[model samples]
Structures are given as structure tokens and as C-alpha cells.
Target: MKKIVIPFTIIALLAACAAQPTAESTESTEPTYEAHKQASWLLGRWENKSDQGNLSEVWEKKNDSIYIGASYFEIGGDTVFSESIELIEKEGVLNYVVTIADAGQGPTAFKLTKSSDSELVFENPKHDFPQKITYNHKGDSVIAVISGKQQGKPHQETFAMKKVN
Candidate 1:
């Protein structure tokens, strides 16, 4: 009877330990949409006019996990460039994807490397040009910067835009 009681007690202890929730399990249960909520401020229309061209970008929240954006550049009332962008959160990872149909290349995806209330940085080191892209949000303006190697030389571009709508 003593042996049987000892075995039963050990089994009960083991079962109790197994039933407890672990730190990793609890962390995995956290809502992924919470991370995406941080980017909600980007939902709007932004425009910039300069000697280079007139640039316009429109961002919209498609759902909890996806944000859609369209960017276009116009010169002399003619659209010279345009691209579609998507910010998607998948399995807790955020990706910035850009597609330019006339570029003759598939969409490029940049992983979110840094983020804050007023800034977001995405990077794709393997890309030929523009390995890093950053967006800094001010009260009613956003400054976007792209930097990388172009033709074996360091290159950077900045677009300072204000919220239009």
C-alpha cells in the first residue's frame, strides 16, 4: 500500500506540472493584431510637390493584418511613375511589399527591422538598390527616405510629404 501510494503521488505531481501554462505558450497566445495597430496613423493621403515631380501616396487599412498603399509621381500633368504597396503582418512578422508593373520584376518585400510611434524602417539587404526604406511621421507630414547602393555607388533619396486628406 505504501509503494502504491508513493507512485500515485508522483504521478499526480507530474500531471500538475504538465497542466501549468508556460511563458512561451502564453506569449504565443498574444494577439498579433496589436502590433499592426501601431501603424494605424499611416492611413491617409500624403502629397509632395517639388522641382523633381509631384508625388502622391495614399494608404488605407484593408483589415487587421493588411494595409494597402498606392504611390504615383506626376510631371507636367502626366503620371511618370506609379507603384502599389502592401504592408502585411504574417505570423507576427511585418513585411513591406512593393510592386511596379513596368519594372519587369516581381514584387519586392522588405522586412520591418525597426518601428516606433513616429517611424518605421524596412530593410532588404539582398536587393540591388534601395536596401533600406524609412518613413518618419510628423504631426501632419511624413518624410520617406530610401538608401542603398546604386551602380556601385551609395545613393539616397528623400521625399518630404504633407498630409493632403
Candidate 2:
């Protein structure tokens, strides 16, 4: 009886230990701040369909809750326009606020209308851009289609980007 009791206690202790998980083992499935920054397609350089040339944006972290990036457009070997994007998130929703620094336009704020693993859309009635920028994954490249308005007419620009360190 003593031998049986001792074995049963040992088995119960082992079972309890197996049922418990360590802190590292219970890690979150969601992306961290660094991962979120990396997951975004806006992190790298892009080109317009026209002669706007390569637009590179460097992302800077603002505290623990915000990210800021700037973009400049060039044409004919000269800088034509420049802009800044401020992105923030709370409760899984991303807010994109764009400022046309060089164009002298006020800031426009947009909300995340739709999103997926490969695509995200930011739309605001007051903003110019409506349709979401679709990022489709190719073999080794990402195709970004930015659809919006240019002089009250609908227009779309496709940009292909390769992730570089």
C-alpha cells in the first residue's frame, strides 16, 4: 500500500508539472513592436508609375506607441514633393495621419478600413486616398498598388519592392 501511494503521488506531481507552462512557452502569437514595423510594406523604398523616382521612408519610433516616417518625391532630377506619415495603433486598429509637408496641405487622417495578412486599407472621407494599398506577395517581391485621386479623378500606381537590409 505504501509503495502504491508513493508512486501515485509522484505521478500526480509529474502530471501537474506537465500541465503547467513556462512564461517563454506561453509567448504571444501577435507581432511585437519591432515585428509590426517590419511587417509593414511602407518600411522600404518605392517608386511611382510616373517619373517620381525612388521614395525611401525611414521609420522612427515615437515612444512605445507611435511610429513616424517621411517620404519625398522627386521628378526630373529634382525634388517635387515631400510628405510625412504618422502611424499609431490601439486595440488592433491602425490610424494613419499624413502630412504634406512640402505641398503646404494640412494633415489628413485615415482609419484602417480593411486588412489581411497581405493587404491593408486606410480610408477617410476627408483624405484624398480612398482605396487601400494592396501588397501582394510574389515569389520574392511585394507588389504595391496605391489607388487614389489626382485632380478629382481616380488613379492607381503600382510599385514593386524587394525587401533589403
Can you give the TM-score per candidate against the true fold?
A: 0.80, 0.58
Error of 1 at 80 (Å): 0.4
lDDT of 1 at 52: 79
| Regions of candidate 1 where Cα sits further than 4 Å from its true position | 1-30
Error of 1 at 37 (Å): 1.4
What does candidate 2's lDDT look like per residue over 63-126, in tens digits? 4447787767666667666788877776666777778775666887777676666665667665
Cα lDDT tens digits, model 1, 1-165, are 999999999999999999999998777565467557777778899999998789999999998899999999999999999999999999888899999859999999999999999999999999998999999998999999999999999999999999998
Steric collisions counted per model: 0, 0
- Candidate 2 weakest ten by summed lDDT: 30-39
TM-score, cand. 2: 0.58
